[model samples]
Target: MDVWDLNLRHLLAVARIVEFGTVSAAATAVNLSQPAVTQALSRLEGQIGMPLFDRRHDGMVPTVAALLLAPRIDAAMARMSSPYVTMSRLRALLALADVGSYAGASHVTGLSVPSIHRAVADLGTAMRRKLVERRGRAVALTEAGVQVVNAFRLAKVELETGLSEVAALNGQETRSIAVGAMPLSRARILPRAVTHFIRRYPMVKLGIAEGARPELVEPLRHGALDMMIGALRDPLLEEDLVQIPLFDDVPAVIARAGHPLAGTAPDRRELARYGWVVPPRGTPLRESFERHFAEVGIEMPKVPIESGSVMTLREILIDSDFLTLLSPDQVSVELEAGWLIQLGALPPELGRTIGLTCRASWRPTEVQRAFIEELAEASAGLPGALHPDLSPLLG
Candidate 1:
């Protein structure tokens, strides 16, 4: 199921054969001989353990496997951008781009340092452009190099997706989705969706990468994650990303069960008197925390610690007078265990919107779409909706 195992040029030949209808023409289009193209097709069919074309007296007739794989190959080739992008050169550049030195690239790829160095050099010469530039002791990609890297990454995504799709057709069930889980999403929505999703798709694996937005966003953009789920930033800064709002999460003032504010519903002024533990300043929760006081026309409280870790926030709040603004879903276990209590709820207007964030250009496979549907169903009633006044408004 590894895209690297399959020849990239041969994959292109498969698409060309699908397009041109004969090995002779596909060979001409790819600038290879007819025998080579025929051999490539035979190799592909052998590797996939399925015929790509029906040999006929008149011409090559595309099979279901060819039809299924051709578009994915075409999409991948389109992203590859240049005909000079061989698998070896592509791997070398990506490895060097990732680790920043020929020695590091060699270590990552297990290729000899000279091999990686020569491959990258050949790639630059083939493209007639500078890809990497030395800066003092370090090296970095040029703007053109960054663009090429992005294209290669996306092309890899397309090829991998095609490989998974073909594997599924053969009943191999290699399809998988890599997801970036923001804190709130992992706390509730992601778990619920994943449980429902796997019941219907037991063979498809889900790799969940949990992190805050800043940590996960780059991977999401680089085609490393199929999607990210959590708070949707207002006026979302990334033009390449598309957000689908699942619901609004109205945060609450959370304190220990027997804290001074536990017995009573405190006003903003009273809540602001004690020290607070909140997410970093720029995050949605912290902005809402600031608004929690601003809404009541009170000065902000002193923040002794800034973190997004539920465990850290829970421990500090339990042991001290510090309070934090959080969705009830984020600390449901502690609340049920009598370790924490929702001291007061922020007005629904000041709440954060939770949802899915995915690359704008992504075309998800069937299983990925099904997972999204499961997410939507789970969002129909969220833990944040447990608050009396705010109901989940599903998108």
Candidate 2:
């Protein structure tokens, strides 16, 4: 069954039944008659395509599915008890979590201190758990609160997507996409795709957040990012994420223009003589670099700086003779502008399959899916876009 068919009341009834272990007790908790609570539980089971509870002589026995879905439903129900739970209440919780204080939330939301306090308290009461803890002068979200906050953020995005979809159906123009851009994408693929996307959907807003894999992965999982573009992991790291291949990104040894190593293929020992700039430790790029060096019978060169910032590395490369390893597409602009030169090419095994990364369960709206199509079209035109060997390797 789909999420849209899910009724909050039915979910709550199921949860309460599991909690109190009887329809009569659950009915009292939600202030409904036992028959009504039983009907709600039935509806919930029908919607989910499974029975959440077994009616035993003693009470209701929760299934494994009920156990798994209970916490999330409980968290959602905590802030959604009354029909009067308004957008303001949701905003208050988000703001409080963001700014870390009721006063700060009040300042950001332009709501009164009392209103913020009431909203936050009501949310906590609804969840039957304390969302925030105050240690005299400090405030922090409890673990349960953090889960609710993430779910609320996901709900907000879903609401926006619903509005955008309805607007599109009615011929109104409004859309937005949040993209997590990695190093390789910032250079060529992502920029080109964004340029094309805007031209195609001018009314659509594009938000880009740049970072390494570790920094971006959590956001994607939490639904804060629509999609991420960059080098795909070899083993496809997270079970909850899906990676779509677009093109092959091969690495190169790069140096400043007119550097002594610019036009020559230096031996491994000669390559080891110079100080280098490399990606931070524990990244795919760093691991690949190390593996490549090990295969060539040379130790990793001395690194003056470890960085993933293209601009920062470019500035350093332009003034010093330091060699840096990078995806060719990442330095396309500098190479074309004569600010950087490709000293040598890396082996094919050093290649990474660059593409899109998103939560495995993500269901993109029409316009959002259109942008993915645009990204694919953009990648098709890049040099060495096809890598037949990559399929087997990634597989």
Q: Rate the local accuracy (lDDT) of all candidates.
A: 0.85, 0.76
User: Which residue ranges in model 1 land beyond 4 Å of their true spot?
Assistant: 107-110, 135-139, 383-395
Predicted candidate 2 versus true structure: per-residue lDDT over 1-395, tens digit per residue: 23434555566677788788988988888778888888888776665456678889999998766765665556554434444345667788888988998899989888998998898888788768788888787678999889778777666555455445544544565567889999888887787888888888888889999998888988887778999988788787578788888888678888999998766889777888899898877777787778777887887789879998888889999999998889767778898999999878778878778888887656676678778877877788877675222222122
TM-scores for all candidates? 0.91, 0.74
Scored by TM-score, the top model is 1
**Residue 206's lDDT in candidate 1:** 92
lDDT of 1 by residue, 235-313 (tens): 8887899888877888888999889877887877888899999999788888888876776677789997889999899
Please report, as a residue range, the 10-residue window in candidate 2 with the lowest summed lDDT: 386-395
Candidate 1 has which clashing residue pairs, if any?
A: none
Residue 224 lDDT in model 2? 80
